[model samples]
Target: MKRNSYAIIGSGALGGLYGGMLAKAGFDVHFLLNSDYQHVSEQGLKVQSTWGDFHLPQVNAYDNAAAMPACDVTIVALKTVRNHLLPDLLPATTREGGVVLVLQNGLGVEVESAAIVGEDRVLGGCCFLCSNKVGPGHIHHMDFGRIVFGEYSRQEITPRAQTICDELNSANIDAQVSADLGAVRWRKLMWNIPFNGLSVALNASTKEIVDTPSSFALADAIIREVHQGAAACGVDVPESAIAKTMGNTVKMVPYDSSMRIDYLNGRPMELQAILGNPLAAAKASGHEMPRVEMLYQSLQFMDKAAGK
Candidate 1:
């Protein structure tokens, strides 16, 4: 496979993890980072992963999209709260059909990306990794790391997608291309629906939320509501799948959720994408998600109180 230049829109934890690893593999990866961390790229990126530590010497970094060169694939890993800012990152310096991977956490990515870059060039993907930025030029992987995606609009699967899969697999990343990406995304949402909000509400880790009786019950209720909501939207999400998602919460112990981390740092929460979107879909399908609606209302109330 021919190597391609990769541009990462968000240089935070998730983007840094994938972008740094790709650059280490000798793909021409450029991270559109904040100006503060641009100096680290002058030398190179310092990736601290569970796989190993790497001081990639050949990594390219940029602070703005204008500085990036033509690329084959562009990874969008920004938080759901900043989904509106995506227009600034699309339209990369690449051919018309260049691959655009949406590595976001919620369901609206494909819809959102298609509006900006058109459906033909967009692919729906989800990251199954847990990572956080520990410092400038550094990302700490908390647990599992892999990515799965598929074309959502019946567009031809670009060689760039297969090449990226091979690259990630070669690096020991358990990457896969989903045959039914909507199902894959709904599965991912099963986990995010409960954990993301409960973690923020309790100010606790995933393990803590699952271990305690009250929090565990809250988590279960939220999952049930989400499953019903998904079914209402004509998505065939199984009850067994919902249980497995909750079970993984215990496995992902010691890991703080994205919402919890955002709340801790006083950043604006992604309640809309994480909670509101699913609730809206459920309502649109004439489904009642009382538990999720409660949680969503509480999060919105909290956000308003925090002046966020």
Candidate 2:
């Protein structure tokens, strides 16, 4: 398998977790840090994982994307709230024919990323990852660190995709390629729509939300709504998606959702991409998502209340 230098645009929890794994495996991974640049530069990244704990004493960290050399594969882990910076981040770090992988939560993300990096060079990745950054250069991995990748156009796995899978798997991160991008996107949403929203609205952790019967029911309802939205968009997501996601949540480590953490930090949550984008796609296909609509509207209000 071939490995290329990797650049991470958002060096937060998701970025640090995956990129750190790659770097530990000897892949040249350049990190574009945010506010944590100084801390990470000083102490490097310390990862405490359920699987194992490791520390990288030093990393190639840069605050400016322009300073980072063009990479053959660039993984974007930016929150959709900061998606407006995608164009600014991609052009400088991705070379011609380089793969731009988006490890994000939401619908139609590939469309926007593809617009900037060309569809043929774009691959969509959905991470079933449970990890967080405790402090600058500090990460905690709770459970579940598998990643699923799909070609933007839903084609068979190409050599590039296989190479990517090989690289991640070499780093001990389970990686799979999906031939159905639409189904994969909606399947990821089955969990995101419910947990991300309820976590923020109810001010609780994953365990708290799933342990409560009422909240669990609410999550189920959102899952059903998401399933319907997927079907309306001509992607028939099986009921197994909901069942599998629920089963995972039941066994997941007690944790704060990314949205909940973002809200607590007074940052803008990704309500638009996770809620509004799918809702628009569903409505365009003549289907309405009442449960998800309520969640979306409530998140909008909560976002405003947070002054983000």
Candidate 3:
């Protein structure tokens, strides 16, 4: 199959890893860098992964969307914190019928994304991976890099969706299509809700959050709350999903979550996309996730405190 043209909108860690892998596989991957535009243009993306380390010494990079050609598939790998920029970015590069896959954490993203790119063009991606950009043009990947592919406005997999997944697989991404996008988002959130919030609020790592008794129980409670919230929103995430996330956390590397890293660096964490949006949806459905709510407030306080 002919590979689709890929334009990575955000040049952060997630964007770098995914886009770098695709580009490394000989796909026509264009990286749209916010800060690392010049550096990546000159030095290319450097990916160091446990699977193997590779480098792209020359790359198709642009600083602004206005300079990019319309791509067959546009991966909006921006942190949900920067989603407000999507409308501006898409207009210049999202060709009609091109699929826009959002590779970000949290809920309510699909809805907003569909509004921007049209339902037909909006696809969703959930990345089960641990990776980060350690410096300009350099990414450090730890483990787990499978991608769950789904459509935002429909349950059935379109041929376009399958092709995109196939393309990702061609690029060495463990990509697969699912009939349910909402369940995938909520299932991923079972881990994100606890680790992301507590990783910051408690100043702990993933290992500390699950290894310690008090924090572990709180993690369980938060997971259940997220499960309940998912149900109230009409998605039945199975018990196994919760158990699986807990199990993975127990054995995975002792890593700092993106939120914790952001907090420590004094950059704004994605408090809204990961926690606040879900909480709002649950509250609207009359489901009160008390423990998750507390974590939300604490993160919010820290976010506010970090401000001048």
Query: How does each model score on lDDT?
Result: 0.78, 0.89, 0.87
The deviation in Å at residue 118 for candidate 1 is 0.8
Instruction: Compose the digit string of candidate 1's lDDT tens values, residues 149-192.
Output: 87878634556567778877776677898666777677787888
TM-score of each: 0.93, 0.97, 0.97
The Cα error of candidate 1 at residue 241, in Å, is 1.6
Ordered list by lDDT, greatest first: 2, 3, 1
Q: What is the alpha-carbon RMSD of candidate 2 to the true structure? A: 1.2
Top candidate on lDDT is 2
lDDT of 2 by residue, 234-301 (tens): 99788888888888899988879999999998989999889999999999999999999999999999
> For model 2, what is the alpha-carbon lDDT of residue 297?
95
| Residues 1-308 of candidate 3: C-alpha lDDT, one tens digit per residue | 56689989897778888888888888898889978989999998899987689989999999999999999888888888878788888867777778789888988776667888787788887888888778988999998888897998898888988888888887888899988998889988898999989999999999998999999988998999999999999999987787888899999998888888888888899988899999999999999999988999998998999991
For model 3, the local distance difference test gives 0.87
Ranking by TM-score: 3, 2, 1
Task: Give the higher-TM-score candidate: 1 or 3.
Answer: 3
Q: Considering lDDT, which of the candidate structures 2 and 3 is the better prediction for this target?
A: 2
Clashing pairs in 1: none
**Model 3, runs deviating above 4 Å:** none
